[model samples]
Target chain A: ELKVEQNPLFLSMQEGKNYTIYCNYSTTSDRLYWYRQDPGKSLESLFVLLSNGAVKQEGRLMASLDTKARLSTLHITAAVHDLSATYFCAVDPYNAGNMLTFGGGTRLMVKP
Target chain B: SAVISQKPSRDICQRGTSLTIQCQVDSQVTMMFWYRQQPGQSLTLIATANQGSEATYESGFVIDKFPISRPNLTFSTLTVSNMSPEDSSIYLCSVGRTDTQYFGPGTRLTVL
Candidate 1:
């Protein structure tokens, strides 16, 4: 079974601060994804890291994947109030037909 | 990215009743997925719905309890049978394209 784990399940940071959420998987997989979910809302796609050393950034959020280490990271730079939400990292196991195993999620609270 | 929509954005249902959530995509997709997110929890893959085949369920899930239908490539339905308080959660449908999976708005089911 593929297990995905995330750190700092709950984070409280002031606006303009920076933080990083870590995601680690038990198995070897190159396809990883980052998603954000607001309260009572569905997930919003953040980034798709397909291979080792692949990094994707949008706005103040950047995501990177290290396949060899079975790890991924979502970096928040200069966070804002709007960045306060639950972030999730998912991993698609090899030949899993795109089925994703998600992490425990990191709930971020950005105080203004 | 694929545009997806789900019906009955949120509902409060009585125990033992069944609710069928519909998922529609703007374009055809080979694989569609159903996920469940309980309150204050992370996402869990319920099943994988593929066009022209029986839906593949994940561990701890069964087709009899959560029946899925993938009539075509652009649409699918997930029926929650014999609902209970434990089954109250946010159900989301997703479609994979390239390296990313786009999700629907989600259906919040509250069983009492």
Candidate 2:
């Protein structure tokens, strides 16, 4: 069975602080995606890490994947209150149909 | 990149009523996925719909309960039949092109 686990399910940090959310998957997969969802809203795509050692950054957020270790990290730099939302990491297991197993999201609240 | 949209951003329905959610993608896609996010929980994929094939439902989902129709390459519909309070959730639709998937805004349902 494939499972994705995320730590620090609820996070509260001050603006300008740096933090990282870790996602660990039980199976090997090359496609890992990160999404952000605000309250009562749908998901917004943030990153799509497709290979080992693949790192992508956009503005204040950066995401990296390590296929060998079956882990991914989402790093937030200079966190702002506007960045407060739930972050979810999903891995598409190398199944024949390519189904995704999602991690329990990490809800971050950035303080002013 | 694919731009996805869902109809009836939100609805409040009574128990035993059924609701249909429509998903539209800006471009043709090979596979469309439907997911449900319950309150305070992660997402669970309901099914995968292909243009000319019967939808493949996940473990806990069935065709009779959540019937899906893929009329074309860029459009699909998911109906929550005989809904109860437990069916109240955010229903999201995604289109997979290549390896990455793009999600629609989602339909928020409130079953009373």
Candidate 3:
């Protein structure tokens, strides 16, 4: 079974601070996805990392993948109040087809 | 990215009743997926919906309990049968094209 783990499940950070959320998978995966969900809302696609060194950034967030280590990272640069949301990482194993195994998620509270 | 929408954005249901959530995509997709998210948790893929075929469910989920219908390329539905308090959750559907995936807004089900 493929397992995805994310640390610092609950994060309380102030605006202007930076932090990195880690996503580590137990098995090799073909692709990784990052999503953000606001309270009582649905998930919004953040980034897609497909290659060993794939890195994607949007606004104030950046995500990178290291396939050899079976790890991925989502870094928040100078977070803002609007960045307060729960972040999740999902992985598709080699033969998973269209199925996704999601991480535990990191809930971020960006305070002013 | 595809524009996906889900019906009944939210509902409060009585236990034992069945609720069918609808998912519609703006464009045709080969595979659509159903996912469940408990309060304050990450997503767990429930099944894979494919047009003109039986939906493939994940372990710990059964076809009878969570029946899925994929009658066409741009639409699918997932029915939760005999709901319980434990079944209270947010259900989302997604579609994938090549390597990118898009998600619906989600349906929040509160079973009492």
Candidate 4:
């Protein structure tokens, strides 16, 4: 079974705090994606890391992929209440066609 | 990124009944997918809907429980049969074109 595991399933932070969510996969994959979903809402694309050392950043959110380590990270800087949501990391195994296998997700709660 | 939309943002249904959720994309896409997100859980791929062809379901999902239809390149429907409270979740539609996937707003289903 191909499994994607994420650390810190739940996190609470104060404004201006920083944290990093880690995603580790059991299989070899070259493409990883980060997504955010609010309560009762659908997913919003965050970042797509396609290769080792691939890093993408938008605003205060940054995502990086280390294929050799079979890991990816989503780093939050200067957290805000608006960033409070569930974050998921999806891994696409090199041979899994275009389907995505998602992790259990990390729930983030940013407080002022 | 394609704009995807799902009908019936939220609904309350009784058990033993069925509900059909519609997904529409702003532009024609090569592939459409359906996913389910249980409470506080990550998104799980239900199946991949291909235009003019039968859907390919995941390992745990079956066509009888979740029937999918893709009439064209930009529209699809997923029907949940004999609903139960265990089937309560948010159903999302995603569009895949040019190697990227974008999600719809989702349909929240509450089976009682």
Candidate 4 wrongly placed segments (more than 4 Å): A94-97
lDDT of 1 by residue, A1-112 (tens): 8899999899999999999999999998889989999998888988888889999889999999999998999999999999999999999896343788999999999999
- List, for all models, the DockQ compared with the true complex: 0.71, 0.57, 0.67, 0.60
**CAPRI rating of model 1:** medium
Runs in model 3 with CA error above 4 Å? A95-97
The TM-scores of all predictions, comma-separated, are: 0.96, 0.95, 0.97, 0.95
For model 3, what is the alpha-carbon lDDT of residue A101? 92
Q: Candidate 2: give its CA RMSD in angstroms.
A: 1.5
DockQ of 1: 0.71
Question: Which lDDT tens digits does candidate 1 get at residues B1-112?
Answer: 7899999899999999999999999999999999999989998999999999999999999999999999999999999999999999999999888778888999999999
Tell me the RMSD of model 4 versus the true structure.
Answer: 1.4
Q: Write the per-residue lDDT of candidate 4 for residues B7-81, one digit (tens) a residue.
A: 988899999999999999998876788999887788899999999889999999999999999998889999999
lDDT of 2 by residue, B1-112 (tens): 7789999899999999899999999988888999999998999999999999999999999999999999999999999999999999999998876667778899999999
What C-alpha lDDT, on a 0 to 100 scale, does residue B4 get in candidate 3? Answer: 96
Query: iRMS for model 3?
Result: 1.7
Model 1 chain B: lowest-lDDT 10 consecutive positions? B94-103
Q: Tell me the tens digit of each residue's lDDT in model 3 across A14-96.
A: 99999999999999875999989889888888888988999998899999999999999999999999999899999988534
Q: In model 1 chain A, where is the ten-residue run with the lowest total lDDT?
A: A91-100
